[model samples]
Target: MSDRVELELGDLQGGILSAYGKRGFPFGRFLLFHVNHPAAGRRFLEGLRPLVTAALRWPEDVPKPAATLNLAFTFWGLVALEVPTRTLRSMPEAFIDGMAARAAILGDDVGRNLMHHWDPVWQVAPGRPRVHILVMLNAAADREGRPVPELEQLTRLVLALAGQSEGGVVLMEGHAGADPRFQELAALFAENPDGTRTPLPTEHFGFVDAIGDPVFDGQYPGRQEWAKCIGQGAVDGQGNWRPLRTGEFILGWPDEGQEVATMGLPLDFSRNGTFFAYRKLHQDVAAWDTWVAARAAELARLWALPSLEAATATLKAKMAGRWEDGTPLVRAPDWESWQAARDRLATASRAERLAFLTAFTFADDPDGRCCPKTAHTRRANPRDMLDPWYRDPDPRARRGSILNDRRRILRRGLPYGHRDDPSGEHGIVLLAYCADLSRQFEFVQQQWMGYGLDFDAGNDMCPIVGAHGPDAKFVIPAPREGQPPFIATRLPHFVSTRGGDYFFQPSMTALRMIAQGMVDPT
Candidate 1:
């Protein structure tokens, strides 16, 4: 019998299963709306339902759609839609409180990341309307990264619906620093002289992004499923790879805990649904470039590196736990190895390249010699580093990676604004989806990224996204004998929160119930 878990594709939202930017739809626009009248809100949803894309597998015979749309509702949105009181109270407290309310716990209340410093749309001033609904539209981009005509048409339609005087839904403004209307997102790309664009996975910081996203059952099809899950999914003590339980990401399914958690009353209302943490994170490229340059100069002298360029590259790789091109440090522990790996990848097949990038273990580097324990990628996903019995002589007594399976989150979203503008409105619209917000998303953010206890790094936060100040530092351990560890000091905040919120992305069934006013919970 096959152990594969079949997902309810038609019932799930497309955004949950697929990262549209990686699937050829790279340009995106996010619009926030405030629902004033429940009746009008339902009417708007009913009209918009047809445009919402489902998580159905695309047929190989047909061309992919030029644009895709998805929807998510805040807790306030459910209230605005007049959902039953019982259902409202049954929601997870973290979602009920929302991202802004939990800012301190998330380490977002300090410095530029404070809620007051966020975009005007996220600032809930006295008598101002709260963001209720979020409509995400993704469209295909041209070779030059410009949006296709279809995106404008779809935008017009959505604007028309929100602009109707009696529609009772008002569009929220001041989200994008460049436009002050809707947040525009686009993946960074390289243009070819032949009028074709090659999407570069790198973010504004010039490092490749989204390299090690979690893989779970039913995420891929057939043989590709297990193949893709290698090193990206749960691992056993015997060093075997397998997909994580579907419930880790989808609702009403068994998770890594081997049981389904309590859902909102009336199973259908919450089945196949999941929670999302929408975050607008602004990257300070100027600060990042300046800091890395100065640090690299000092590192060149300390480490006796060849040149400033090599020192800068090594410095970035040390902090990121991978080379800028997405090669894991475990696979290429030094500059020479990184260069060799790059050469191999230059002629490797796509599948072969992926394995080189992700198929590696941190068990050997327990002391973090190859990759710093506090490196951004290492902190975010420790892999086997968190295993309690990893150091045990008896391999059978070890717990490989059970501890991290529950904390994995599906990352989706794309970079926004121009990459050339160092001080301009530029950042990533980070979207994280998981069955439980506190367990998966919040835990990773608070414990892994914000704190340093798990990695034995003593309050030293992740250098990439962690809140930093003059006292902040990241230690890079030297593997060779007689070489002292290099400490990069006086770290600056590389990334900061601009605006964000918690949202519940419902299944198609739940959406229908909401639109039809059949969400009864007695």
Candidate 2:
């Protein structure tokens, strides 16, 4: 399946990955630490942070002193301890209790919060005892070529805290996305002190060693320009935020008002912060591929095209409201409109552009006629095209109208795992940047992915990544200019949301404070 890519070593967490082979539990955590320098990161993290410790914060208005941190956590939440990194063999009774306690905290959400929601089919998977620790550093280093950070040292700390023995197993994981810095780090790690890198597999479809970074190069100055208007209304001299100019909903400037500092807790209060969500979703590759093949057939029939390209064109046209080549179907249903919206979304005020896209036209009716409500892009941001009938009754109405959208997220994750590995399932780690996780990322998942109701109402889940019934059957209603909507039926599941969790990415200032052990939660 196109979406069911291969899994690679680069994609799998370095520690305890092999345990999955026997369905054995491998507990782990992915951590991103804000470090003042590589030296500081290593020295401070030589031992695991205790769970009883207070949350830290950076000081106000202070950017990180050139270091930052983020962490990914995946453990059974059983046999809990207050200390970090407990090993299986050496795990103390206290550590086991800590794990158990943490697991209990997570289970509390099982029947209540969508945040706690997991596939009923696979709750047993995580229920198995395991821990996967993944960490990401998203800040510029004090200087490159600092003695490479030791993965083994960090692992040992975690094992010690968990009270597990050395043979208990642990892996230090790293990713090389499209980013140059990450590439540098991966290159360093993939090689030994003698300077030889791991051999690239001829047929390896797992994660590649190519590094990808999350920091945007600021080639697009719009982010800086838009920062000024983030809190203030997007308006002219009259001060009325114009619908023609900006989107209906505006988040305004990020720094406006007496907002809580990034490090309001035990950390410095001066740095910026980013949130993260992590998951260790296992893919049943064989099953996913089978579903993809079956779904492709349905797509072929729906678009009346024999090739994937033609079907993709129809799919893209309906979802983007245009084609990949950039044609707006509303203006020229058959042409591409990549040019119109691309630069505009990156440059124009959010509201100004959103209004234009959401402006309904008689030429393309969305009432189950043109774009399906569940299309990926459509579900992410409905562009005010959701059926009015369903709008009022939206279970998540507190998030407000989707027409004038806000809380746009910037995606920077890279594809992981193997591209052709029959043994493993692989895809992008799927990272995003949003002003607020609750307002933006969480909203999209809950309303669109979980609810699966969009402009068309009671339609199939999103064509990509969205879920539907246990059978995983899906369909995309056809979009003929004047003809009745043609339902492309019986599509199979391709991109399954294996599993993930939310995280808070602290700025450099926060990292320094965290190292100093004085972070305060905002």
Candidate 3:
């Protein structure tokens, strides 16, 4: 094993390592900008530089800020800022082409997900200004978990600075249909009798989300960090878990492939930097609920389940590879087991609960008995199932997660709009961060989620987030002896792509270089 890489937290952006929602900032707004004057745009970036949050860990004595800010730029945005030609040319092709241009490959070109059907902001019309930069603002909720007044104040301040008469940047419009300025993001919350709100882990589809994010090296402090990597990071044949290589996520470091991939012209320009795929996924809650209800009814009779409630819960768990409460199906295969696990979790310590939720492997459930091979979670990560020697009869011969370690991505962002209003525009703002776009983010989106050949389910898509048509189907293998598999046919399009784009969130050093126009290819 190589020496562990030490991350320079101060040089990296906070959004790369931290999910702001979990850090007390559950409410956020995404603002887009178009730069018309290169020099003036540089001045705008220089003024906002100090406000951008770094990944440095907060001290125990110090309180976190009320809000956090981060910035990213598209390829055209770099050009608008007059970035050196050499540095611009060095960027990956997938990013330079942008998300809309690669819609077909990402399975976003069909039906409502097509480029034309996306938000007007993402569409590059003849007379409209093209999107160049993305500004993310995450604000802390009040004691009652309600939106604070400071959020709006901070948003207005930033908008005014960007749209100032002398500034070169223009705030883009037409997000989320009615909201022409910026898109608002908030997590789902439960209301109490006292009028207090508590954020929930469930998404619009009712499945517990934001679980099992990849743990890379230097993400956490101390020896305990290794313990947190179990089932969440790379695993050896002996089932020993450890944080994945730093280069797998951050630039200018050795990746799982044992090579430091070529970045832009200067090393400082790319070090600690990462690429982001900003996706706005609109979920059709009415369609999802109606489908789940009908499927649960049929499954109740076919599986001889006790009640409609049990069948409903079981069918959902199978589809998501976890119960609605975030319990992995591999850990709690049935309704009774799920209930028991939930009961245990209610009293377990914080550490114990974290272990229970993430510590599980697909080694024992090879045949998709407990969790379906094509289930959303299983297909998304695969864990040790993709190991070269996974099928060896002797468990000792199985190598662990060698192929999967390279494809991991850091997931950020939160749910947007109200979940109760199903017909209203609502879903998740998914942010995926990785060092390599094509190798990591694009590959998973295209191969794993879009196609099912790796799982031996040819032409089938991921039941939950896959881009398959209405004719697509999902297979849930029988869990016990003498029980037949339940096949869901003619699946509906539950999720649609609203809009998105690819961007490079540069390191603090790179930001300074861009702000001062100091980039030199020579």
Candidate 4:
């Protein structure tokens, strides 16, 4: 028995999953620094790599390379940073700074130029991390903003520890696209011709999405549990954490198991390995502006509102169960409530909590009025209102068949993209994590987003953002006991599905092993 167990264990170790779950910060920046020297990339990787990897700890017996590292900011990403806060505090302050200083140390030859840029596809409110450093702050507040002064303070702290550089550049671009400033620097490095230079747009459309999410269990124990299954159990039964044959999220797989490989190096073969499929979706902001402006009166009238802005805000407040600032409508349904709804919701049981969220105007109009049935939220997770409030067609199958482990991806990250709207080219860069994308994420998109068969009999799509053809119609639910259902009206598409793909977030141990060219096919 002992010998058999030993053989089964073989070179396999755990901890990869746990390490990722422990770190809980939002990955504020997806930086891509352009280095002129051949060794620049290596230098940058060396410095940032350690900070990211050193903080990560894996389970025992997992066969991983010494160099691979992973850092996640959100739930999925945070799961990979297994180090305790105490350990992080013990690390040298210099090493905790941004990628620049660390890059300078590893590849001293890379030039120092701070190129600041912004993404056209993203229209985030001003006051967030234009850049990120290793210190903590108060961005966790519901309506809080990340100030620049705070950023400067964090930078000075890094400089004090990491030494000096040639100066730095700031760059921003479409969420995944290149920052204009970064692009300019790149052009300078490559010496591009005058007309050949691609100009950066100040505004655009598309979602600014983050990529690669780690599987989240809980905190410490979650971390430990994950570590124990580095390459064994699926990250969770859901299958979101199932490693690609190449062992992206785990280890102990052979090279051929990978979907792709080159030069003896196992390439990422797992489909949807990248968390968020990032694209700088182009948009005609100017034209969109004109169209909205011209039809402002018409839109306001259709929504029965005083202004288009009010209508938009009204719609948002209803669907999200909160305002754009993250205030929950349930607690502050009156918009003048003293106690915040978000706080209250945070303390309730998972079931009650999900129900309380229905207070959003869309689910239950604050004015006891027109939000109506078949609304977005109602269609997606009808819960008590649609599922419980009313009896199902087949009462026996109601409870069981409805939720039936319907694939449901846990919402784990922020949505990024441009603020401006361009005709029919605006949509969220939906980022979700699941043990199984086929079941959870895809189920919601197919059953809920694509069809209205999940909840009410109304054929309404998400009014504000849902896409229906030129002649799309909304079937409003009847009010009270005897009201007849009404067809609101035929609406044009406001949101369009531009493009999207999924990806996996590997555990640090798994990454290190892959980087080092180690594969255990068995």
Ranking by TM-score: 1, 3, 2, 4
Superposed by TM-score, candidate 1 places the C-alpha of residue 96 at a distance from the truth, in angstroms, of 0.6
Clashes of each: 0, 129, 0, 63
Cα RMSD of all models vs. native, in order, equals 1.5, 13.6, 1.5, 16.2
What lDDT is obtained when candidate 2 is compared to the true structure? 0.35
Flag the better candidate by lDDT, 2 or 3.
3
Off by over 4 Å in 4: 1-27, 31-48, 53-355, 358-373, 382-404, 415-428, 456-460, 481-486, 497-500
For candidate 1, write residues 1-522 as lDDT tens digits: 138887888899997877887888888999999999998898888888999988887764234788988899999999999989888888899999999889888998898888787888998668988999999999988756688988888888888887773759988888755777899998888888988887778799898889898888888776566898888988866677888888998988899888986567678888899998999999988889999999999999998988898899999999999999999998888888889989999999999999989887788888899998889999888888788888887878867777798899999999998767745688899999999999899999999999889989888899889998779999999858899999999999989999989999999999999988998776
Q: Which segments of candidate 1 are over 4 A away from where they belong?
A: 60-63, 165-167
After TM-score superposition, the amount by which residue 398's alpha carbon in candidate 3 deviates from its true location, in angstroms, is: 1.0
Task: Report the error of model 3 at residue 49, Å.
Answer: 0.7
| lDDT of every predicted structure (CA atoms) | 0.88, 0.35, 0.86, 0.32
122 in model 4: Cα distance from truth in Å? 15
- For candidate 3, the C-alpha RMSD (Å) to the true structure equals 1.5
Q: Model 3: which residue pairs collide? A: none
Q: Estimated TM-score per prediction?
A: 0.97, 0.50, 0.97, 0.44
The CA lDDT at 44 in model 4 is 31
Off by over 4 Å in 2: 1-43, 46-134, 137-271, 280-309, 315-332, 335-365, 368-370, 386-407, 470-478, 481-484, 520-522
Error of 3 at 195 (Å): 2.0
Which candidate gets the maximum lDDT versus the true structure?
1
Q: Write the per-residue lDDT of candidate 3 for residues 460-485, one digit (tens) a residue.
A: 98898886686899999999999999
Ranking of candidates on lDDT, top first: 1, 3, 2, 4
Relative to the true structure, candidate 1 reaches a TM of: 0.97
